[model samples]
Target: MNSPADSGAHRPTPVAVVTGSDSGIGRATAVRLAADGMDIGITWHTDEDGARRTAEEVRAHGRRAAVRHMDLTELPDAADAVDRLAQELGRIDVLVNNAGTGTATPFLDMEYATVRGVLDVDLIGPFLCGQLAARRMIRQGGGGRIVNVTSVHEHQPRVGAAPYCAAKGGLGLLTQVMALELAEHGITVNAVAPGEIATPMTGQEDEDVTSTSRPGVPLGRPGDAREVASVIAFLASEDASYVTGASWVVDGGMLRMGPQAGSHLESDAWRRP
Candidate 1:
């Protein structure tokens, strides 16, 4: 919560909108940005208490925080949420599209309802948010930052995650297109792809993921939500002005292993034991 009065004698404090920020990486990003002298607009789905906690943490960092309840799967109203936040929080200097949905289902057995839910939240929702944020930034006459929270599945396929992979893959390309179109306007769009972070989404403790010495990861650890937040904070700042349209992988070298190949012998592979 760095105060504008305390930040410096020059420059206006920035305002940031972080979606799905009630918990996990989104929450961390909001706190980090607040510490960096930015007022925060946070959106949450089901966890009002979590969102309130995040807002309190942001305020503790000395920055103003506004909390909003939103359902990102509602595609038509997604952009409206961003617009509302921008109006409420003043000009939005940074937009982090972190809201997403996914479920574990085999591709062949997946229902249209489930697939559409994932796509609407992960891909289409971000599209709407990006459009709205960019429009606001353009009107504000100042360059802004857009950070999309993608996943490693954006680059590689994952079993039992067909729609999730598809949505993230589309989002990866969409981010590049937005960057190309917005760079001339002094706005930069980039993505942060995290792998095996110790978040509720993975249901694994930090120590549990870190202690299992996986053969491929050079770092030999699972990432913390704050670790990913630090990178997002950097990208949203003046320091990352030149960087755009790139997907920075924060996977502790797990992605470098390519597909999960092992020499383990099994009588019937791909079958539940």
Candidate 2:
């Protein structure tokens, strides 16, 4: 009798665990991946209802969906949700570290607790979660994908966002290191850095981005969640098998405004932060 390996068994359907999938880019990415024929593991912090809604969307695509709660600020324990979702969904083939938080206080006025919370949610959370996902992928003996959702601040600085920029910048570099180290295991890591997007995080959820105005941004407005999701979907697909350690900027030319913005500013409002 032939053994299981020699029996030509079919592989299970792919599974993806997207953190903070209750809304915004996370929700859009979960739906997009489901449409790509992968089961989804959805996570939410305070928005269980929104997570259920996201799961409904995934199921609408005829893919399996599992829901969990993940509070990144909770630290090493929060990452265990990845393992639970992977087990429930049969396997973990992709991990999108989309859960994060930020602060708007100036550097001098920022509290230790606030800075720590931002770092925990944005940087350390992804770090621990990536470790868990990568271990599972290595054990499964196949390739995997990890997409870290950073910000345009990952490349530039925002006046009011000190800890936020630091966390994102650190995550951007961490993606590269993970890509380099995990290449041997066939796990590609990448960062999706978005500029100003119309998400609840930015107080623009459900807003019509086309109608918004932003003189500093080359696109003249904010980006839709789906726009960012499309790029993330590409990075999570086989088409990006050869691509890794790259930060795909979906910012609508916001980062390119360094010189122009410096010259066009009319007041000291930029320094008030």
Candidate 3:
């Protein structure tokens, strides 16, 4: 009849809640953090199997793994998921707000519901989860880490991605504000804006990282999910304690190609929706 805390073979380890972790950058980040000696709380929206696999991978690294269902469009539910994870794991040390959605419909043709869906999932959902995690961290008496997974579009824009660009832009600014307010509480808020990565979201599932090329990107290839995850791991680590309110771009200089230097090819190509 031992207490749960004393029953564990090992002492407590930090825990991280990674949303949309059934695949893509979420899964990669979860695994990487586990390798960094942190237990993982894996969340999935639609892919239960993927989430289970991610949890298994985390456990494979000799860390605790808990799976939770999360859908960002349901903000209240999302917050509940966070609370459950933290409670189950004893505490939440990090939260990666990676669940999001985008749209390609023309703005004029978009319905109110469509736009609202994107905003709810991308912007409002992260805000809710961030608030919940921050509150928990404050209660726990130690610092915590929150990494928002934005996109390169956070600073730029594309034609068909009006809703997405708007949400990411809003989240980017929100990240700064959260950092400013949460600093005194020992919670560091930051963002990771990724470029084109070879993942299911990019229609490049199962693509080999060693054999991919993207000519438009200066690096001449798509980024691997692990590459982005590495950056996230760094931001969540104690090493980044002094860093906050920052957006670390993992794009291979894609944003730098913006409009080019002098070739002003001003066509309506930007509105390709």
Winner by TM-score: 2
Residue-level lDDT of model 3, residues 68-155, one tens digit each, is 8888777677668988999999888899999878887887898888898899989999999898889988987777899999998898
Best by lDDT: 2
Ranking by lDDT: 2, 3, 1
- On a 0 to 100 scale, what is the lDDT of residue 39 in model 2? 88
lDDT string for model 1 (75-166, tens) is: 68755878888899878889999988788888899999999999999999999899999998998877899999999889988888999999
RMSD of each: 4.7, 5.3, 5.8
Better of 2 and 3 by TM-score: 2
Error of 2 at 216 (Å): 1.4
Q: lDDT tens digits, residues 19-73, model 2?
A: 9999999999999988888889999999999999999999999989999999988
Query: 151 in model 2: Cα distance from truth in Å?
Result: 0.6
Model 3 weakest lDDT span, ten residues long: 259-268
Query: If ranked by TM-score, best first, what sequence of candidates would result?
Result: 2, 3, 1
Clashes of each: 3, 0, 0
Candidate 2 local Cα displacement, residue 192, angstroms: 0.4
Pairwise TM-score winner, candidates 1 and 2? 2
